[model samples]
Target chain A: MSPLVEFRSVERTYPSRQGPLHVIRDVSFTIERGGILAVVGESGCGKTTTGKIAAGLVDPSRGTVLFDGENISGFKGPELSRFRRRVQLIHQDPYSSLNPVRTVYQTLAAPLKRFRLVKNRTELLHKVRELLLTVDLTPPDDYLYKYPHQLSGGQRQRVAVARALTVNPDFIIADESVSMVDVSIRSSLLNMLLRLNQELGVAFLFITHDLSVARYFSWRGKTAVMYLGRIVEYGPTPEVTRLSAHPYSRALVASLPVSDPRVARLRAQDDEVGSPDVPSIQNIPPGCAFHPRCPLYMAGSCDRDVPELMGMRESESLHQVACPVVLTR
Target chain B: MSIRSDSAPPASVDGATLMSVRDLSVVYRVGNRLVRALSNVSFDVMPGRALALIGESGSGKSTLGSALTRLLPRTAEITSGSITFNGKEGRVQLLDLSSEELRRFRWRDCAVVSQMAMNAFNPVMTIQDHFEDTAAAHGLRDKAKIHDKAYELMETVHLDAKRVLPSYPHQLSGGMRQRVLIALSLLLSPELVILDEPTTALDALSQRAIIKLLRRLRQQLGLTMIFISHDLSLAAELADDVATMYAGQIVEYTDVFSLFDKPKHPYSVGLIGAIPDLSADGASLVSIPGSPPDLVSLPSGCRFHPRCPLSDDKCERELPLLVETEPGQKVACFHWKDAQTLKGSDAFEGRNS
Candidate 1:
């Protein structure tokens, strides 16, 4: 079967007073049916923009996004509406993503009622309760009447997830969904998403800044490391996180503070990046965007030539990195 | 450093205690309800050492930070406690200080770098103006000296002082703004610095940069610090000692290595296990089952009993005191032995390995 969602050389830009701000450039990846693809990056690296484009919430300025072998931009009328229903976007802040005045039942039932998925009030109530149970809000009656304000942060987020599932979306764009939640409850939310992916066969395009979180949720899937609007590394999650080929990816993995102090100390002693400054999107560094901060940065070639993503080894390994210098080594 | 209870003797070993907090409790009034933010919290801040107060939201870590500087909101009240600071001048009671004396004590003796660096700065003021205002407030009349000191401090933080000093806070990135705040916090060269979730808002790379900057600052200045954060990894990275707070109480206090490797408190063990380790080989996370209890109406006896796996009738009836379980390790849980035994099992070893 074809992939659930595919992005072919997607590029998104916003017109700014400085110039056309390149928020996303030459980004391409695919999430198979029931597959997971985690896009890990910093705040300004356009990971959220990538998710928006994938969900059809924002149109890519260049290239195409295909949903189940059909071009998303070309869909019209019912097809577009169907695509919208099939793909859901979960925002980062559950506190603001949910309407304050709406109860859990009201929030979940609207999608079902608007989509005409339920015939009557009884059907709507039953479906909403089922959705809540799927998201693990037990004794659904207790939560059905609780307002967003009445629920805790974790419950509010779970409600957000249940609302996403109301349309029975084939694809879910979770944009740092668990980051705002408390640490102790973060894993439960991720576990819920993982279960949804496995049991329900729902694909996910998980966007997060946390490498560990990305690695954890998508352990069996693929990961794409974004830097300044480009995919610097794209490969199997374990391979990309454990044995990263790109200098940027290596730095990110190494710089991450481990729970163990000995490991954290050892990682700190590794070669530090040359610079910590990230250039503005409007004035992104030429050639390799990370060359300025890269420790193994070559003077001439790194500043002059734009590197493209290629396999690191001679064999047909799925792991790919966008640094020619590393590839040559 | 030796472990002791709240009623233990004054700092006699491992140098003098820089700040001693004894039986501190804070309450916040919302409507008619009085929310207990901190309950009999007591700890000593050692000079030139970094101590991390690690906890999740509503764990009273941030409230403790605010209470240290007496910066709590109008609704909040420090009902009982003694915050004594051993400064270069003499031993002073922070709680008893007059408003003018407290004003001098805040930036002159101790500085607090809050979590919200984005909103910390005055948007109307340039970076230079901020420095000038801070120095001027501390009674420094020489503008040139203030500018020179600011320039040197900004450079110390690895920012291009020539460009950054003139630029507004908006012109700089999140990381740069955070660095600016750190530099401003040190403008007075206070004896201690308290950073509350310093890197919580930044990206991973920027967070790393700030971490590196803080580590360097600690080493170069021999700075005494109380780092407040919910991230265990960060606590492991920067802190010499770790204090685990749960439901507005200190559940565990020990060195960073001991806390991560052989955590005694059940909550600390669960918290450490919950963190996703990049080095670990696909280990399943063990999240604590229930959410933190509301402060207004807390659980009976031990606050953590509701969520603790080791809770019993004794735990539900009697509150546990923070007492020394071993040399340099203090735990408030009655089932700390069980928690330690649980940590020795294969599951935790597999994840830690």
Candidate 2:
């Protein structure tokens, strides 16, 4: 079967004061049906832009975002509406994405009504409650009539999830969905997404700057590591985090402060983590954009030519990395 | 620094206690209701060690930061307790100090780098003007002296002094603004530095950079730091000691290493469990079940009982006082021993329901 979403060598750029800012370049990936693909990177790495491109919100300057077999950009009118209904984007901030004046019922019901999913008031109410239940906001009566301000941050985020689920989308682009929620309640939200993925077979393009969250949330899924608008590593989540091939990916993984202070203390002492100030998009360094900060940076080859994503030698797993040094090794 | 009971010696034998807080309780008046923002929160900051206050939102972590620097708003009042700073001159009572004295004592004694460093600066003023004002307030009236110090600070923080001095707050990036704020906090070379969620607004790269800078500054300057953060991992990375707060009370206090390895409080265990472990992929996170209790009308017994898995009748009716369960760990949980033995599956079962 065709993948749920596919990015065929996507590139995105915007006209800027410095020049044409290449926010995303030569990125390609696929999300299979019921599979999760976590795109991990720091800010300005084009992870958000990639999510937008997948959602058809931002038209890529080059290449195409394909939903199933067809280009998402080609969809129009009824097709566009269908695509919109089938693909949902869960925003980062729960406070701003939801309307303050709308009741939880209205927020969920509007989408059900817009998509003509329910016929009458009774069905609408039933469907709304069911949507809330699906997102684990139990009993439903306690929260149906409450305004956004009446609920807590986690509750607000659940309502946001319910709003997205009202359309019964097959694919979700959760752009840092749990980043804004309190860390204590973040797991519950992530578990809710996991349940949806398991039970409903919903595919996800989880975008986050946090590698640990990506590792846990997309355990059975694949991970794509982006840096300066390029996918430096793409592979199974566990392998990518544990044995990441690219220097940048290793740096990111090393940068994470483990809960164990023993390990964290050791990591803190290690000077080989994190990149230098990320070069601006207008002036992305030639060759490997990460060469400046890489510990094993090859002076001549790495600085002269950009490396293509290649499979690591002697590794049977489908782990791919974009470092020429690693590839040569 | 081993954990000691509440009855332990108030001051270290070596006089290493830079600041000692005892039974520090703070309350806020929201309209007519009295909100108990902090309840008997006490800890000590050693001369050059870092103390991390880790907790979720509404857990009074930030309130503790504000209270330490006497930056609490008009609504909040410190009803009881004493905060004694062992300054170079002598022991000084922070709570009893007059407003005028506080003005003199604020940055010169202990400084605060609050969250949202961008908003901390005035939009209309250049970065240099802010530095000059701070210098003037501290009685450094000479323009040349202020300029020299400001340049020195910029150099320390790795910002281009020439480019950053004339620029307004908005002209610099979030990381640059945060660096400037840290530099400003260090302008007086205060013994204690209170950093409240210093890098929450920045991206991962910038967060790493700022944290590295802070760690370096602390070492180079021998600064005693109080890092207030909700991120347990970061707390582990930055602080030497960890104090876990819930609702308005401190539930756990110990050295960072001991706290992470053998967490005695259920809340601490739950907090550690909630974090996604990088080593263990697809690990099921065990988040604490219920939300924190309402401060105004708290639970009958322990504030954390409602959400605690090991809570029982005693925990529900009688408030659990902090006890040094071990040499270096103080925990207030009634059944922390059972919690420590109970594996993740047994402890977290039905808790997420």
Candidate 3:
């Protein structure tokens, strides 16, 4: 079966005062039906732009995006509406994404009503309660009348998820969904998303800067590591996080602080990147965007040639990297 | 690590405490209700040690930081507490200091680097102007001398001083602004520095840079610090001692090694279990069952009892005080002995499993 969504050499650029800013370039990936693909990167790395492109919310300047084997740019009217309903985007900030004046029932029921998913008030109420229950907000009656201001951050996020599910979406783009919630409640939210994927067959494009979170959410799927708007590493989640081949991925994984003090103390001190500053998106370094900060950077090749994503020799599970220095070694 | 000439003496030499808090309780008046922001919170900061206050939002970690520096908001009142600081002159009670003395004590003795580095600086003023204004407030008016010191400190924090000192705050990136804030915090060379979520706003790579810089500063300067953060991994990376706060109380206080290796409080265990571990393959994460309680109307007995898995009638009826479970470890839970046997996953197994 064809993948649910595919990006063919996608490139997006936004006009700025200092010429055109290359937000994302040569980004290509696929999200299979009911499969999870997490895009991991730092700020201004174009992960959000990539998500918007996948959701049909933004147009790519240079490449084609295929949804269900059809080019998204050609979709129009009813077909575009259908695509929009099928692919939903959940934003990062629950506090701002939700309407403060709308109650939980109203927030979830609006989408259902507008999509003609429910006939009357009773059906709408029942559907809203079911949506809340599906997201694990138990005793849905207790939350139906509460406003966004009355709910906690976790509850607000769950309500946002329930609203996204009101239209019966086949794919969800969760953009940093769990980052704002408290750590004590973050795992439960991730577990809820996983449950939805397992029970309802919903695919996810989970975007996060946290490597550990991406690894946890997409353990059985794939991870794409983005640096300065390019995918430097792509592979199975565990391989990308634990045994990464690219210099950027390796440095990111190494620099993460382990929860155990003993392990943290024993962490190798050689993972330091050359510079602490990430170049502005408008002024990204030429060649490999990460070469200026890569620790294993070669002088001539790293500064002159841009490396393409290539498969690793030793990895059997389709692990690919974009660093020539590490690839040739 | 060669000690700098201006660095303070090693903390372990005399084993003297730098700052001590006794029964500190702060309450904020919200409309018609009195919200207890902090309750009987107490801890000690050694001269060279870094203590991490770990908790979620509304846990009063920030309030406690404000209380220590006597910078609490107008609505907040210190109902009961004493903050004692051992400085260059002698022992001084922070709460009893006059307004003028508190002004001197804040920057000269203790500096606070808050979480919002984006809003910490004046937008119109250059980085040099900020340094000049700060130094001028502390009676250091020599511009050339200040410029030289600022240049040295900026280099210490690994910034390009030539480009940064003349640029306004908006010209610098988030990471650069944060590093400048750290540099400014060290301008006075205060004995104690309080940082609230120093790296919470930066990206992962930038966070690593700040952590490494902080470690280097501690080694070279023997700086004493109390950092308020919600990230457990950061606590493990930077803290010498870890204090876990839950609903305005210290649920667990122990060395960093002990807190992560063998936590003795149920909340601490739950929090540790909730963090996703990258190194451990297929490790299941378990989140706590409920949200933090409302401060205005708290549950009876222990504040954490409502969400704790091991809570019993004894835990519901009477409040538990901080008691020594080990040589230096302290826990404020009635079932701490039972909590000792529970791993992070075991504590919240059925909830998320």
Candidate 4:
């Protein structure tokens, strides 16, 4: 069977005054049906752009975004609309992402009415409540009449999640969906994601900068580390975080503060995030974009040749690291 | 250089304080109905000390900050309570102050360094002019002296004086913008510096830089501060005392050492549980089950009762008061004693929900 989502050598770029800014590099990955894949990176690292492409919002500059082995890059009109039903994007800020003027009923009903998910007003109301219930926003009656601003940050986020489920989409690109919500409420949102993945078999491409949230709270998922618009590492969540192969991944994991002051003191300091500059889509250096800040970088090899995604000599698992440091480790 | 709470915790800050906020509440009439942005919330920021108002968004952290500085919208009515600032300005209730008086006291006596640095600075003007305007407005007629002072401040806050002085807000990076704003705040040397998520928008590098600079400034200048943020770990690093705020009320507050070492409140315990401990097995985070309460129509009893793991009938009936826990710490919880009992085994164990 074909994978739920496939990006075969996909590249994205945008036109700037100076030149074309290449936002995403030759990114190629596949997520199985009901799988969760996290794409972790810093600001301006093309993670958001990647999520946009997966959501069918934008066409790639160099490659195509395929759903179930069908290239959906050039899809339009009915095909696009159908793709929209199968693939939905939820944004970071629910308050801004949602229409403030519309009531929750309108917000959830639009998709139901458009997609014919329900039969009549009674059925539609039931469907809306079910969607809300799946996300743990119980007793939808309490929220359906309320405006977006009437809810708390966390409640709004849950409503956003509910909206994404309105179309019964098989796949979702949750673009930092919980980052703006209250930290106290973020976990409940994560729980909803886990339930959706388990109960509905919906695939998630969770994009976030918060390492802790990405650490399998939503669902046990494969993790990818992106740097300078390139996938630097990919593996199981446990290995990706606990046993980080790439220096960049290691740096990011170390960056998160711990409770104990002693262990926190002994932990390695992040060799700067290299100024969060991927040098734009057009100007990324020929070799490793992370060479400037890499702690274990060998000047000649790292700057002269970008290492291919190669696994450690002995590990059977697909834990690939794009760095020369692998030889030493 | 570091003050340890080990020997004996500091003296209990009595009701006789430097600044007193009495029955403070902020409510906005958003339609026909009234929305209580902040209920009967109250806290004090004594001289030469800091109070970390910790909470998630809509917990009235920023609303409380605005009330103290009197910078809320005109529609916002301070329904109750008086926040009296008794410093160099002497026995002045912040609510009673006229626009002109608030303006004089806004930055000179009480300056708020907001989260968004862009909004704080005038984009068209140079960084130097911002300091000059505040200085000039506060009756500093000597231009050369102010210029020198601005330059001195630039160095003090870890900004390159030459590169930052003439640059616009857009020219500097987000982190640099934050540092510039912080430097600008010190221009008048305000006695009370109220910061609202000062480092939220910044990257890790800039966050570290801004935090370090704030610590340095606090240590060197002896400025009493009320620092507000959602990130407890970041708050734990800077604040002397951490006050966990929820539903527009102080749920639990203790010195950073006690808060981190031995959190009395279950809400505080859940917060610490949520943070990913990178060093410890990178275990999963045990996040709180529900979100913050809606201030407009809060639950009958405890606002956090719904989310609290140890919540009981007492928690559901009577509103918890900000009562004293350990010395110098306070927690508004009915089951602090029982919560303390459950905390020993599972509180720190297993991060997974």
TM-score per candidate for chain A alone = 0.98, 0.97, 0.98, 0.93
Error of 4 at B100 (Å): 4.8
- Where model 4 places Cα greater than 4 Å from the true spot, the runs are A74-82, A100-103, A118-125, A144-149, A259-286, A294-308, A325-329, B1-23, B29-32, B40-42, B46-48, B79-104, B219-223, B279-291, B306-313, B341-353
lDDT (10s digit) by residue, model 3, range A1-329: 77999999999998988999999999999889999999999999999999999998899999999999999999999999999899999999999999999999889988898899999999999999999899989889999999999888998999999999999999999999999999988988998899999899999999999988998999999999999999999988888888898888888888776889888877888867988778899899888899899888888888888899999888888788998888788
Model 1 Cα lDDT, one tens digit per residue, B191-237: 99999999998877788889989999999999999999999989888
Instruction: Residues A7-88, candidate 1: write the lDDT tens digits.
Output: 9999999999997999999999988999999999987899999999998889999999999999999989999999999999
lDDT of 4 by residue, B12-88 (tens): 32445567776677888777676677766656667888778888877788888888888888888877767878788
Better of 2 and 4 by TM-score: 2
**Candidate 4 DockQ, CA atoms:** 0.37
lDDT of 1 at B110: 96
Q: TM-score of each candidate?
A: 0.96, 0.93, 0.96, 0.87
Worst 10 residues of 1 chain B by lDDT: B344-353
C-alpha root-mean-square deviation, each candidate: 3.5, 3.5, 5.2, 5.5
Q: What is the lDDT of residue A8 in candidate 1?
A: 95
Instruction: Say which candidate scores most in lDDT.
Output: 3
Question: Which candidate, 1 or 4, has the higher DockQ?
Answer: 1
Task: Report how far residue B325 has shifted in candidate 3, in Å.
Answer: 1.2
Question: List-wise, what DockQ does each model earn?
Answer: 0.72, 0.60, 0.75, 0.37
Across residues B61-160, which tens digit of lDDT does each residue of candidate 2 receive? Answer: 9888898878899999987777888877578888888999899888898899989887899999999999999988999889998899999999999899
Top model number, DockQ: 3
Error of 4 at B296 (Å): 3.0
> Docking quality tier of candidate 4?
acceptable
Q: Candidate 1's chain A scores what TM-score? A: 0.98
